[model samples]
Target: MAEQKEDTQRERFKAFSHVFDEGTLRAIHKESSIGSFEALQSPIKIGKEANVFTAVKGDELRCVKVYRIAANFKKMYEYMASDPRYTGLKRNKMSIIYTWAIKEYRNLLRAREAGVKVPKPIHVFKNVLVMEFIGNKEPAPQLNNSSPSNPEKFCETLISNVRTLYQKAKLVHADLSAFNILNHNERPVIIDLSHAVDLRYPNANQMLERDIRIMCEYFKKMGVKKDYKEEVERIIAK
Candidate 1:
């Protein structure tokens, strides 16, 4: 039965094999071999840098994110280079990509510890990460696709989450926006923490301002009245 299940999972993943180099494949297999997850079920989201898949883990589901080795490492390096945590990191492509995966795992851990609503990271192996799934039977829709029932209340929740992320976690989500937020049953759940940087990052304040502006602009369209500057002040207030 176990062998048959593995065969089925392999066939399912075969269609997306182009993104999985031999090294990444070995990393994924190691996760299963160690019982991190039972098997890959389906793709959650596929993109240029990373591919997220939903996998079975006991009675529940887990998300597996695989950072492609062929991704635009130059762009990743440029973004990662500014992060104080990765300062003086080797410019080697594989090392940068692997570090990107490790970075996200660490960021998620920090955010969770700070009481932020984010996917709970399970384990990170090389360029692959296993984390808690964020939805019910089907994945939640992105905030851009699913508007909230009460925009005012929802926006407040998100703002509070962002403030908590900054004040408690001391990290700025450099790439935050509606695109990376999941509207789960009218609540906001932030995702895509790979671009987040510690407060000590050179451009952390600018990134936090950008994050607030983008969120306020998006929420403004939904009838949530908020001044971006005021929100920024609110966030940065000691």
Candidate 2:
């Protein structure tokens, strides 16, 4: 039975073989062996560097994020280079990618510990990360795709979470946007912490402003209006 199951996973994995290298395959198998999740299911989203999938773990569900080893990680290295936590990072492709995933895992945990709303990280391997699936049967739609019924409330929640993330967590989600925020049952759940940085990063303030600007622009389109500068002040108020 186990051999048959392995064969089945191999076939299924081959469907997306373009992204899975031998290292990725080994990481996925390790996750399964350690009971990270029962099995990786269909791909949920295939992005520039990673692909997301829904997996089963006993009676519950999980999300598996696999970062492509062959991805164009130049931007990733550039982004991570300035972060103090990753100082002196080697330029090796796989090393940079793995460290990128590790940084995301650490950021997720830090944000969670600081009471910021984010996916609950379950496990992390070299380039794979497992986290709580944020949806009912199907994964929740991005905030952009599934417009919230109460734009005002949704905006407030986003702002509040941003406040928590900045003030309590001292991390700026450099890539914050509607695309990375999920409107899960009308509440916002932040995702994609790979680009988040600590408060001490030199560009943290600029990144924060950019994040607020994006949110403000999105909300403005939704018939909500707010001064971006004032919102930033409010979020980082001491």
Candidate 3:
């Protein structure tokens, strides 16, 4: 029975391998062999640059965000080059994308240590990141897709998360907005940390302001009466 199951899993992996490059397929297989995840279950999200898939690790569900090597490499390079941490980063397309993935895993680890409500970082190999799945059975919907019943409370909690991320984590979520946030059981779970940067980054303040502006605009539509500029200042003010 175990041999039969192994053969079945290999067949499934072979089918899934078609979706990625040969190198990526080898990396996935390597991760699976090392017990990171058993198999790819289904795609949860198909973002512009990365594909988010649900995978199985033992009995638990895991999220795997795979950066597309064949996608818009120029855009990915532009974004990554500006970050201070990657100052001496190579101009190579695949290397930059891999660095971006590794950066996100590191950022999430920092956020988790800071008490932020982000998915737990499990493992990252090359351009693929394995993380704790946000929801049970199904991946949690983005905040924009599934608005919380209590907009005010939700917004407050989200801002609090931002505060924790800033004060405690000493990092800014540069791409924060309704789309990157998940509304799980009425609580906020931040996702998509690729754009997050440390406070020391040269463009950190500008990215922080943009993130605040986006959240403010989103909450304004949801009827949260507050000044965006003031909120941004409040979060950054020591």
lDDT of 2: 0.90
> Model 1 reaches what TM-score against the true structure?
0.94
Cα TM-score per model: 0.94, 0.94, 0.94
- Residue 167 in candidate 2, Cα distance off native in Å: 1.0
Residue pairs with backbone atoms closer than 3 Å in model 3 (clashes): none
Tens digit per residue, CA lDDT, model 1, 1-238: 9899778767766766776877888898889878889788889888888889999887999999999888898988998888878888899999999899999999999999999999999999999999999899688889999999999999999989999999999999889999899998889999999999999999899999999999999988988889999998999998
Displacement of residue 113 (Cα, Å) in model 3 is: 0.7
TM-score of 3: 0.94
lDDT of each: 0.90, 0.90, 0.87
Writing each residue's lDDT as its tens digit, candidate 2 over 1-238 gives: 9899878767766776666878898898889888888788778998878899999888898999999887888988998888889998999998899999989999999999989889999889899999999999899999989999999999999999999999888899999999999999999999999999999999899899999999999999989999999999999898
Model 3 CA lDDT for position 4:
81
lDDT of 3 by residue, 1-238 (tens): 9788777778877877768888888777777778889998998877778888999887899988888887786776787777777789888888888888899999999999999999999999998888999996988889989989999999989998998999999899988988899989999999988889888878887888899889988888989987888988889888
- Model 2 alpha-carbon drift over 4 Å, by segment: 1-19
